[model samples]
Target: MNVLLVKDDCGRSRKTCHMPTHTAIIALTKGGKQLAQRLKTLVPGSEIIPNKGKIHQTFAQAWQDHDSLICIMATGIVVRSIAPLLQDKTVDPALVVCDEQGRFAVSLLSGHLGGGNALAQKVADVLGGQAVITTASDVLGHTALDLWCRDMGLAVTDKQGLTRVMAKLVNTGSVTLYSEYPLPPLPQDIIPSRTLDAADLLVTSRIRQKENIVLLHPKALVAGIGCNRNTPAKEISEALDHACRTHQLARESVRNLASIDLKSDEPGLLAFAHAQNLPLDFYSPDQLNQVEGVAASAAVLRATGAKAVAEPAAILSSGGGPLLVQKMKFPNVTVAIAEILQPFPTLF
Candidate 1:
């Protein structure tokens, strides 16, 4: 998808990826299979995987492909089947276990970051059961740090620090939050801090890291490129890295890329976008010229129809958002960065 959209209070569309969209529902017993069939219909992009008696083989085959797995079987069966396939929680798929009677849905693994808790709750709603969430934050009725970051489309920069912060938050029952952008009313446990130094959790695109501080980088930045013909992907990558590093911005915060339509067929640019798995938006000269506050370049105008490529393209692609970094030149490439305003969802 080019840009994932979430509706704001005024119904304005904003870019956001809430959670895993693909799910695999697996069942071993006849009664369990019936429950899985019902779930497959209610869950979007979910498929029922009939157990062929080899539970390990079935799990191994579907482990890498699916974002989440719902096993309609005993919790012990699921725990044993997926134990060997468990990896880092960040990349591990969410696992939910449901009883054959459909009386309880348990978030078995990756409760927060991998969205296992949310999936369990959803499954419970569909089956008219109780969702068993054991995560400390959920049990205590406090803000779930990892879930909040995931819902906001923010990447955790420091995994170790996040764990520490989460432990402390659960113990102390509160955390101070600092953000570059304005946030909506927060949970009772999350108090907004005016300064970054006083906060335990930070929401920003800037690359800030410290001991015991959890940095959440939102995917809200767009990069615009102006490159010479046949500019290698390495050169473009280096230019982007240099710009972000020099400006203290996190590369993980970049949402997509933008460029003039004249370079739509450029192989190097296409390769770079594909490698990064980022959507590249191309605009015509007329569209670029309509954007204001872009630096004009006579050379760019002569080469392409647009007076400016990097600056105007960034501005237009960001929906007229303010520029964070004006055109910065490199050996064979130029880059400009813009911030797309992200709306904060209701946190309470």
Candidate 2:
């Protein structure tokens, strides 16, 4: 992941962020320039982002370009400027702060899933300072919800449920970590359960609705799509997005896109997969037609020489799991969702 280091002054403050792994730095003048040059020695791939007048603007620009941020300036200044860009724990980049003297490394924001807390610890390790982390779960020695989901590669279907369930974990209440999949050792605060009625945290791919239950969907869903020639990638994307949302499926859980090999070079389908950053797997018409129980479409069979493309491709790509979404047609695109098979419903 790309890291952005923003510094106002030199000294240990700038050096604290110049970890050997950092990729770039943004420095305001007044001693920041020389620090950037010196930082180049320690971090090979790191580039110095030159800044003079408005440090806030440079920092803002880095917010979009980088995966995580480390500010070697006052925490208040960093917070005020980044307040506008703070979205949520899932989408926001990790942010850390260090004083000019580098006495303390603080995780200012996105400490859990975004990895701010770990970055702070790394900074402290480098500068021989204290890593200041104040998140309740971290302080209380409980498993952080965001960290747990991230570690398990699960995507929360409903973020609202996650907030409430996290509150429970932080408040000394137990959370049932239900997984049919064998998980590693879990924290004391999380216990395994089998039923939704007894669960506060559920890890599964099946659609479920419950209040105050954190639902983590594993990245085990596979999608298959078929689109008309020259169809805009945007429309295909929107159609798949709608299908996932409407079915209460986690988009992050989608492993890849599948389609008939006949369209191996189809630009529209390839564009959609590229936009989603998922691999596109294509099978020949014979392969797609062999998958049993795919929804039949006379038109698709006539046009593509396959009885069904979307549903069968999805099931086959997912290694023949049950289909979560049957073929859904919208505009010039057809989409389907299937869960990647696992031994159990929930995994540890």
Q: What are the runs in model 1 whose C-alpha is more than 4 Å off?
A: 1-20, 230-232, 290-295, 319-322, 340-348
lDDT of 2 by residue, 198-225 (tens): 8887777656776666677777888888
What clash pairs does model 1 have?
none
Deviation in Å, model 1, residue 276 alpha carbon? 3.2
Residue 144 lDDT, candidate 1, scale 0-100? 88
TM-score of each: 0.84, 0.78
RMSD of candidate 1 to the truth, in angstroms, is: 4.2
Once superposed on the true structure, which residue ranges of model 2 sit more than 4 Å away at CA? 1-45, 180-185, 238-252, 289-307, 328-331, 343-348
Q: Over all chains combined, what TM-score does candidate 2 have?
A: 0.78
For residues 1-348, write the lDDT of model 1, one tens digit per residue: 243434445232233323346899999888988888888889889998766868999999889878899998888888888889998888899999999888999998888888899899998998899999999989988888888777777888788888888888899988898888767677788889988789998888888756567888887799999999999998999999999999999999998888887787788887788778777777778878878778899999888989999998888777788899999999899999998776353432
Which candidate leads the pack in lDDT? 1
The per-residue C-alpha lDDT of model 2 at residue 24 equals 42
Predicted structure 2: clash tally? 6
